[model samples]
Target chain A: MNLVLLFPILIPFATAVACLLAWKQRHVQRVLSITGAVLLQASGFLLLVSVWQSGIRAVQMGNWPAPFGITLVSDLFSAIMIVMAGLTGVTVLVYSLADMDTGRESFGYHPLMHILLMGVCGAFITGDVFNLYVWFEVMLIASFVLLGLGGEKAQLEGTVKYVTLNLMSSALFLAAVGIMYGAVGTLNMADLARHMGTVKQPGLVTTLATLFLLAFGIKAAIFPLFFWLPASYPTPPAPIAAIFAGLLTKVGIYALIRVFTLLFVQDLEYTHALLLVLAGLTMISGILGALVQNELRRILSFVLVSHIGFMIMGLGIFTHLAITASVFYIVHDVIVKTGLFLVGGVVRAERGTYEMSSLGGLYSSNPWLSALFLLPALSVGGIPPLSGFWGKLVLVKAGMETGQYLIVATALIVALLSLLVMMKMWADAFWRDSPGSAAGGSVVSANPVSFESRLVLFCPIGVLGLLTLAAGIFAEPVLTVCSRAADQLLNTEEYIRAVLGGIP
Target chain B: MEVVMSFVIGGLYASGLYLMMRRNILKLVLGIALLSHAANLLIFTMGRLTRGHPPLIPPGEVRVLESIADPLPEALILTAIVIGFGVQAFAIVLIRRCFETLGTDDLDEMRSTDRAP
Candidate 1:
């Protein structure tokens, strides 16, 4: 009943309402939105400290006990997810303010931004399955509006496919929930875990499990179901694109981990094997797509898909160590990927396009920006002393311990290819001279030395990049937390007892 | 009666999948709507068939009557239908917008923009 647990959701929701009421005054809306983001970050930090000191916290809405009432629970994993969501929300807000056009901002972008954050945070913290579905819809609806906010030809066309695919996925998600509830007689995740233990319908369970996987798979942009992502993601403005690239897919992964670990562990032999095969294919195919792409953003989108395999690989291995590594990787990938996309935005801004062939020579003109971009890029490539390296190391170790030889090999090879693709981007964008260097073509340099503009974009990135270093350097403590989270997930009785007051 | 309901459900699913595979934008919307209906019905059927009993309990009874229909799945189906309707409405609007911008309802025409040209 600690009120702090509610702020991460409430602050943004309240701010969104406030922004909508004051929508005519763009400056006031901006102030409210930015202040809301900062407040969310502060509250998230406080919640994290509380969760670390205490055990998991469960808040049953309306005080109707769990298994009966809707609940919002925050375990260590969820707390970490909330904090990451807040950090990303703030970073994207700052970037959007600095980068978006005034006309676009006036079209309720600020309010929508706050609402989107509210949905994301709520999804991360909610304890009930049906509530998770509702949050997914809330988040998707906002994203649908945001994706088409620009109303360009490409944006409109891409939004069609994006909306269609996601809508189907959403329908499937509801169907899955229906089936689960019908089978287990409860929508509460904790209750379902208990009741599911007594169910004898293996065939029906597998079907429902597969349905859930497909629904989440599409959202996460896994290999077979990922076509919609690269198509729609590149069409949005950079801030929108960056946040989507970083945060949205991870929601699918989060749901996957939560459902698979908590509800479907009895059938892991089947599901984990399926996940392993999917991970291998996802890694190889995603990188191959990246390798062939010429456009900067498109290539990054494919690479983003490829990196998802690494996280899923950690889950497939299903060890304490492996799950921990997956958690660490998820946090690292979100920050690094978002930073890279923001850097991509900067690149596009300066060059007037996202095509690598049409742009170059940024390193000399803006060394600081280049450095900021380079750190995350290298980190994502799994260079030492960066966050990416530690995550990969843990996954590889877990893979070998599980004797999953092929998965281990695939992970290493994918890591190499990721580095190659990133290096190619670096060479093409920063190292080479501009295409019209001899002609001295008019390049739209948006104040190359503007400290305030650069600070607005780079500070969030700097904080994330520092986190990358810290995660790598201080892997032990983070791993310990992940282990506890994993243990809690695998041990169903603890969750049930905590929620249902000593279990039914 | 159960066999007939299952056939109806299967027919809906088949038609939905067929429409979804089509290139026409309007058909895609129809496909989603049909598929959602089929799924909701399938979930409803999973509760098993009950006969000769209403969903409500008698006023004096402390527990539900025997052979009563499972009301939980019906409640779930109702919620899902409302959600599906909202999503479908939003999709229809988006499709209309797409048609306005691209000047074609054909998926083939939309492909050139999403893929590398």
Candidate 2:
């Protein structure tokens, strides 16, 4: 069980080292990455079982105990995150194998992918705030390399903006950490939660909380801080873009949830009200951006920002049910959003462009591709009997319970807008007719024998689609675990005792 | 001493914020550096300046403590300094590449490629 906690981190780190050593051998790197991702998925599942059985477990490094040393803790929340990350890691690795250009493969793309996975896993499991910062940097650096791997004109241009904005966020994060350390005298989250309770200065704590919120909010692509996401996410290759869209921003949300619930619950009225306003504005603005965009990938990227507001809204209400709903929504969004982006990638690869204005009739020429996209699209739009519907239902129920009428109303409106956006994508990309439809029809006829590429592409999307369905069908068990995870987060005494050996 | 350090940190942070808002990429990188330095100094000062103490007790002395300078803040500052150096290095390289490829450092000029022609 303990070893399971370490595998997600270690497997990727080992594979990253191997990939770097064999940098010149593209095939070797690909094979190794795929194998590592599979192993990581297995390990993640095993860790989930252990977490379910034993409750939250903590592993201290160098045997130095908790507050003074780095610790990796795995509760149900972190365990579930690892599994999702692993699943996405494998899907993206396979997609990249088929989708990445041969010339670009020679330039360490697989290595960076593995390193990014390492950072993702590390961030989920880390119990210390400083270690969280370290993992964030690790992930950002790898993303910077991956974003610029092709060195194309647009890639370079996007990389500059991405890197600059992320660097500023990182600076803010460091500044927050410094302030936190100065105030609390410890960096361990559990320890800080205890110390924060003792601090008498409300102004200082609120200031620090705001600083942390700004930093993580930028990463999470929440309102007013989401300008960089739509600008830069579309410039990367589809596989890279898909994973980033799926996972990276959620890391910030994860931190936000952890900090607000465990450490800063003293001022929930103020913080929750602020988050409510931000979430409302983010939802409206993001969907408007999506509606106005004609490009397929950029529209999807903006939709990602809008959907993020749903999760934030859930957290703002700050109920047990609401947090659970937020957790469920995040997991559902990660799978459905990434699957949609990969489908977009497939469309681009076939049509040689992502412009909705220039693409059409894919449904007639490639019914399987069209069908493949329909499941995730409908799921993301919160259709019933899908995972997305369950999350939205939970959140809406929680909102009504809490009497947050305005937030509930805004959420319903956004959900409708989301459906419209997905339908717009489906209509333009798959249903409408264009001048190149005739040429596309003939090209598919000529390529009647390339089932391997199609299989390779569809397998990952199929797995994700199935999981989305299964998660919806089996919402009972997943929700149970989420409820427990939320309970643990809200009950800070258990976490403190697990880390620091009983309250003084 | 505390007042002087506080002023220094404030000045650095103000300049850093100004630079960070500039259009030039190099200026942004420098701004991050200045901001980090200010943050580190602020953390150092928050430990509360105490003279004539080194945070170490003499060998086998039974509770002979004389208000040492807070060692934890020093350790935090060291770690923060190292992390800042790595991020700054990465930013410098990124800025150089941006200047070379974009042929301009002005952020406003880098318009969206997908904008309707």
Candidate 3:
């Protein structure tokens, strides 16, 4: 049963290798990518079911025993993340067949993408801290190449900033891991959590926790460390941007949640309090940044940063209910956020540019695209009456119960403010006629979009939109999984027993 | 000895950060290299400096008795060093390409991607 935990990681690794073998054949690579994604998605669901049935599953790789060896484990949280990664992985891989250019495709785009997928799966399931670091490097190297693949002017510019900042974070992450190992003598997360309270150095753990927060905060695009996000995310094409937008920061947030709930809980008063403050600031700053952007992708990028705060808000509150809400927020945000970016691509496909000033009459010309765009814009950013509402609602309720009314109020106000930004987007992009095409002529100045590409773009949006609605309308099942995942997180003994084995 | 190495590590980090803050892309890449080197050394020092013990154990023993120098951090640093080398290599090539295309080595002019569109 523990072997089932390896399937998510292995499938993508195998798929990526296959893609590399067919490097010269884009057609074969595309077919292989989709098949691999489907297999990955299937494996994710299987792993989730296995975890559901068996509680927590762990497998140790190579020769060492559990604590000293590299272990792969799946609890509810890891399984759910794998499943979500698979979902977006499939949609974006399918969407890329239409969206990515031939110039980019010739340069091993499919193989790098699968490697990225494998890295993500590896990050989600790894049970050791150093192993997690290695997986992160995998994701980073692939993303670095992907971000700079086409070597366009804007892309190179974006890649420079993106590379420098993320490398800083990676260095800090390494230092923190080293310090933790020095202090604890183990890199296994379960062992670290078990031994964290007994460290001889009095204030070292707090400092290490702060170091982790900084490292992951940069990755997750929290408040001060987030400029690289808006700087780079807009440079990539829609499908690439969508995958990065949907999945990348969430990995950082996942690490933050994992480390805080498990390894850093001893100093909650200092660490978690700081987290709460940062969450509020991230919410305010991100949306405020969005309000000034005229570009469709740029606006969506800022909104992505803003809503990342809501997920952190759940983690900051640090209660079972709050954690459950955070997990649900992650699921909702991943589906909705990826959909929003893909829709931005569609809007660009319809018009000539991503600039809202140049884009208009989309609703009148192509109402289907307009409606699909609305599904995500109106859904997340804590907007009411949609998939995003349940997460925020529970978050606010949890915050109120915890007597953290300031952050809760900030959360509520940010919700309304984000709604205002989304409305402004709708008015600017869909409601107004183009400045020149006000007389109802379509403003598709770019090359005529092919039917296959159109299908490629809209299908992902439709599927994500449906998933968003289903997550909203059928909130019970998702919420149950989230709540149980939260329970497993807050209570790590089962995880410890699974990974370390034969212990209380 | 640990204290002296700590200062050395601190100095490396300081210079690394100083270089990273420079406008020249070359300097920035150099800074990244310095920073990664500092991190690797920090890991090396933190693993506790025991000279020439050579983590090998005698055949009769089940384990290296009396606490042989921990070998894990060396392995960790090896991995980090390789990853860092790859990243720095990519960064150097990227700088060349950026210079060829963007026509500037200064980080300030690279703000076209960040400008309000």
Model 1 regions lying over 4 Å from their true place: A439-451, B47-71
TM-score of each: 0.95, 0.94, 0.98
For candidate 3, what is the interface RMSD? Answer: 1.0
Scored against the true structure, residue A131 in model 1 reaches a CA lDDT of: 86
DockQ for the candidate 2 complex? 0.46
Summarize candidate 1's per-residue lDDT along A293-369 as a digit string, tens digits.
88888899999999999989988899988998888899899889998998888787766788888877888777877
Best by the DockQ measure? 3
For model 2 the TM-score comes to 0.94
The docking category that best describes candidate 1 is medium
- Whichever of 1 and 2 has more TM-score, that candidate is 1
Best by lDDT: 3
Clashing pairs in 2: none
Which DockQ values do the candidates obtain, in the order shown?
Answer: 0.53, 0.46, 0.81
What are the per-residue Cα lDDT tens digits for candidate 1 across B51-101?
767688889998885769888777767877887788788888888888888
Model 1 has a DockQ score of 0.53
Summarize candidate 2's per-residue lDDT along B21-61 as a digit string, tens digits. Answer: 89888888888889889988887887877788877777999
